[model samples]
Target: MDASIFSAPKIDCHCHIFDPESFPYAPGVFYAPSGGEIATADYFMQVMSAYGVSHALLVGPNSGYGTDNRCMLDAIRRGGHRFKGIAVVENDASASQLQDLQAQGVVGIAFNMALLGLAHYANADALWERIAALDMCVQVQVQDDQMAELAPRLLGCGAQIVVDHHGRPDISRGLASPGFDALLRMADSGRCAVKLSGYDKFSREALPFADAQPFTDVLLSAFGPANCLWGSDWPNIRATRRLDYGTLLGVFERSVPSEADRRTILVDTPMRLFGFGTGGN
Candidate 1:
């Protein structure tokens, strides 16, 4: 694959940083990565540099560290201009705590419904107002069937909505998935954005993930390039086997195929949403 596509500065809208020694995994964590591979800010930066990624959104890994965002915040602080973070906060968390998180380079809050479920957000409305006041976006990782029910509720909170993992569609069911439809509607309203990441998680086929193309096509069409952001989903934990970062980038190049569109997905969209170069508060 031609690596020229990555020569321009790009933003990884989703990725993680973990340090079991400094920020130990939460007891009863869903998935604890063994062997300490790809578990530090330095290692992730090395991989990003190798792929020509200039900036990234360090998402709080809910499954590994639960609601503890210290590792994510530490990574962003150390990464300087190269990183921003999405923290995972308790639904009833105080506004003062959110202010502290925002000061720590966190640009958003994460709701990993895929693992934690909707019940995790019992105080979502109040929390949304707090984050919104700070000009932060809400990043969500949810199952395919949850979109229709969740999108409206999120929109009601009045914060920008960012749906993760291609809306995590059930490709086996094609576009018939109600959640996929809801996602498209959300995108159409210009109130939500979708991360064009995690094809490996949703793809049923082998490498190159050609099987995920149709879903990508629909997303690009529905969300348009301006609202679609690309990410490496680095250290793809759920991958059955080792997956190369370069190969994942290649998959995105093939999936989108338009240099202009790729530029928006890879750079413009995320920068605008996360307020990277704008010197966001």
Candidate 2:
């Protein structure tokens, strides 16, 4: 009998929680997620329970909340070991604030270069160094060839890096794309991990995102099982179409057919990267 994908302990390495009702959106943000884009912590926990997902690493989104991490902080506080977080902060945010976040269960800082632009974080090297000093990771989300420019510093920053969305590679440019190549090269440093998710962000085509598969294949090969992880990208914002959680899992299941690989991506890697354990709720 085939092993069930639902039977194993799984962790979602990237996802977001939007609770504007309790934590209002930051004023004058460029994009505010509403309607289908909202997922309260309670709702997400139920969804996780339904899918047999044991824990999720909730991201502090740039869209609505910007540098305000109260929403995600509250969720982590209430989640009872079921949630960990990556927070968003100003490039010049102080060490005290970051230490406070870390004390509250945030494991990393988010660099949403895709939304905030590269220029915004050009002076972030010191911030990265500080994050590394605290033993936390930097969660990066870059689009097109942006990572090519940032990879050099990020690799040298001494922080554990978790890259978003298979590097959000420009599939039209193929594996030879400079940005994608740079992202792949970061694997050699052993401090980088990539998520197999957010297909809608880079894929020119629909559903299984066939155009993006070559990039994903290269990522899986280059990053290897230990550095590769799975994420639902829950509460997907600005999506071209509706993306169901189960459907997303199915796409990942099809992409990686081997049960051993699946377990590594779904359970083991996230455990190592996000600090989830079997003892947790």
Candidate 3:
């Protein structure tokens, strides 16, 4: 692929940083990388530079670090303009702690329903107010089957909703799938936005992930360009097979196909949702 194709400034709205030695992983964490190929802030920066990604939203990786966001916080502070963060906090997190996180460039909180259940967000009302006061969004990771029950609750929380992993749809059922349909309905409500990410998680196919394009098309149509964001899901830790950063970028280009739409998904939408810049791409 031509490097020029990625010339427009891009923001990776979802990625992670893990430094277990400094910020040790929680005991009995659900998942942890077996090999030593951990992703760090400096490594992520190198990847971003190679891909023309000017900014990134470093989400707290639930699998490795659990709710300890110290590693992510340090990265955001060190990265300056190059990185922002989405932290994971306990339900009883105090106001001052949230303020401190906001001052450090954390624009949202992450709720990984796959690991933590709905009970984890039992204090949604309070969390909503705290995050809303900071003008932050909420990042949600839920399986396709959980959408119907979870979407309504998240929408009612009164904070901007960012659904992760193309809403983690069931590709076998396509658009007719109940969870995917609920995702579309949530997007239609105008309060929710979906991240065009984690193709490796949702697609049953191999590289190029052509099978996932229809889901992307429907999400773009339902949410429109402004409410949609694109992410590399870098390092692609969950991938069953080897994947390349450049190849994934090409997949996005081929899937979206229009320069205008590409600009929107790759640049404009994330900038607007994550508060990256003053103007559109």
Best by lDDT: 2
lDDT of each: 0.82, 0.89, 0.81
Give lDDT tens digits, candidate 1, residues 1-281: 43466686677888888788788889998788756344699888888878778888888886678888878888877886788988988888888998898888888898888777777676688888787778888888887788878888888888888989998888888987898888888976676899988877777888887878888999899889999998777777767656777888778888888888888888889878987773322
lDDT tens digits by residue: candidate 3, 1-281: 33355676678888888777677788888888546448888888888888778888899887788778889989987885777889988877777898888888888998887557777676676887677767788888877677877777777777888899898888887797777888899876776888888888879988788899899899888998888888888767766877777887778788777778778877788777777873221
lDDT of each residue in 1-281, candidate 2, tens digit only: 55777766789888999998999999998889999788899999999999999899999998899899999999999998989999999999888989999999999999988877999998999999999999999999998899889999998899999999988877777788888889999999999999999998988888877787788788889999899999999988888987888888888888887888889998888888778888684
What's the best-to-worst order under lDDT? 2, 1, 3
**Clash pairs for candidate 1:** none
Count of clashing residue pairs in every prediction: 0, 0, 0
| Candidate 2 collision pairs | none
Candidates ranked by TM-score, best first?
A: 2, 1, 3
Better of 1 and 2 by TM-score: 2
Scored against the true structure, residue 198 in model 3 reaches a CA lDDT of: 88
In model 3, how large is the Cα lDDT of residue 27?
87
TM-score (all chains, Cα) for each model: 0.94, 0.97, 0.92
